[model samples]
Target chain A: MKRALTKRIVIDGVLTAMALAIWVVEAQIPLPLPVPGIKLGLANVVTLFAMFALGPLDAGVILLVRIGLGSVFGGGLTAFLFSLAGGALCYLLCLLLRLVVKDKQIWVLGALGAIAHNAAQIGVAIALTRTTGLVVYLPVLVAAGVITGTLTGLAAQASYLALKRTTLLSRLKGGASLPKEPDDVAGEEDETEKKNQK
Target chain B: MKTWVWVVIVAVILAVSLTVGVVLLTRQPQGNVAYVYVDGELVYQVDLSKVDQPYLYTVNTPYGTNVLEIAKDSIRIADADCPHKECVEQGRLKGSPLVCLPHRLVVKIAEDDADSVSR
Candidate 1:
């Protein structure tokens, strides 16, 4: 039992590092548009994968660590607040989505998550600035969010499918021995079989 | 559900937002007053309709300084020390506000006395 706990921590730590790296690197790239709070949001791919494969709780830990560390590394207090609001909204949306979305439709979750994240960030921006004029950016932000969210969501779905069959994940599941069978993410081999038959 | 269903939903959302964005971006600003803000504090309010001559105003913030060009009917960032130059590129204010995130500077158009007066 102790071993499993240790393994889970190590994995979550590794994933958080991965997310932070992506966040920092992506920040360095010049945005194509002039809009603030708009980006590819590549770090969210890891968040979505962790949420789906490991669990929401695991994903939450990784997300919090990533946002906290990310702000220290590449942002300030204001940026941290924006990220926290955005990340929390995205995480909560994912938890709600898990109940309805099928494994094959993970991309939908990604798109919606992106939109929700952007909306929450904009809310923070409005509150901090105390300006209703910033609300004018909403339409553009919403459009951008849908596009970027779809990309990240598809990326997460692809990663989830690829990692599902890896011996590492199997070991994480059966070896660490969580007796894992959530109604949301069970029957992996069966899913593969169904895919193959189709 | 079919993957197409998700695609359709996203498509509809994208279409709607895009239309709204275009409308907002292209619409003319209705009011005469333009408010300048730095770090969320109101610094200056210019009544564009009242200005007979074009002028340049400089806003100095801890983050950086931005030069704004104010004209009879329009306001724009003429120059900025920020890296991206996005504020400068944003051109004149139409319906949307001009924002320089790095410098925490914003220029917004107000339509009525009440709008700028409330702050």
Candidate 2:
């Protein structure tokens, strides 16, 4: 049981590392919306996956690690604070949204999360800049958030479906040393699957 | 087929979008940037319609002289010491922000007396 759990942790670590790498690489690209706090929200995919796979606590760990690591790799200390503020806000919102929302509707959660994140960062920027004049760009940032979050939600959903299909998925879902399901493997998982049953 | 493909596609889309953004940003009308000066202290109260004639505000930054003009809106330095002159080229900032990276100065349209969306 412990060995299986170890292997699962290793896999989660690897996936988290991959997500961090993507965050780093994406940062190199210039932002399209010059309105201040807008972004493509590329790395939110990993957070979505982790949220679903490992639950909110584990997801938080993944999120903080990814942000800390990604920020160091991409932006410096001050820069990290900006993105971190945004990412943390997004993470919290996504977690809350996950409970009330499900299935494809998760896209809406992602969209809202992105918008919230952007809003928080803009607030920070306004305070730091000592200039409250950039408020005009909020509309554009919200619009961008809805778009990018939808895309990321779709991407994460696809990956989650694929991962859930794997045997390793059920094992991880069982949690470390949690009770293992017996005789379910030969019978195409439980009837809990809403999409696959169709 | 691969996750990296999604990343690459997003990156490409972002690159194209940013390129388009630069072009569009350049085309935006250069309005006036009002750095409100009250009682010899630099303030944030520059009005375009209120001002009768074209007025120029000279600002010294790391990028040398940043000349902002107030007509109907706002416009900035025609010539700059900075290589990227993006802020200068940003023109007027009545309804937006003129971000000059070279000088770490951002001139944005204040929404206090404005009739636009709220912050």
Best by DockQ: 1
The numbered model that scores best in TM-score is 1
DockQ of each: 0.47, 0.10
Every model: iRMSD: 2.2, 8.8
lDDT of 2 by residue, B1-119 (tens): 24454445445544554455455444443444356322223545576657777766666753355666666654454555553454554544534666543344566543445567777
DockQ of 1: 0.47
Q: Residue-wise lDDT of candidate 1 within B5-109, one digit each (tens)? A: 878988999999989987887787888899999878999999998988999999998888999999898899999987657688778877778887767788988
User: What lDDT tens digits, residue by residue, belong to model 2 across residues A1-198?
Assistant: 676666556646755686787677766665644565455777777777768866777677777888888766745553577678888899888877787665545555566777778777776666555556555555556657767876777777766676676764666666454435444532333232223212
Window of ten residues with lowest summed lDDT in model 1 chain A: A189-198
List where candidate 1 sits over 4 angstroms from the true fold: A177-198, B38-41, B49-55, B60-66, B71-74, B78-89, B101-104, B112-119
Model 1 Cα shift for residue B32 (angstroms): 4.3
Question: Which regions of candidate 2 are displaced past 4 Å?
Answer: A1-5, A175-198, B1-33, B36-94, B100-104, B109-119
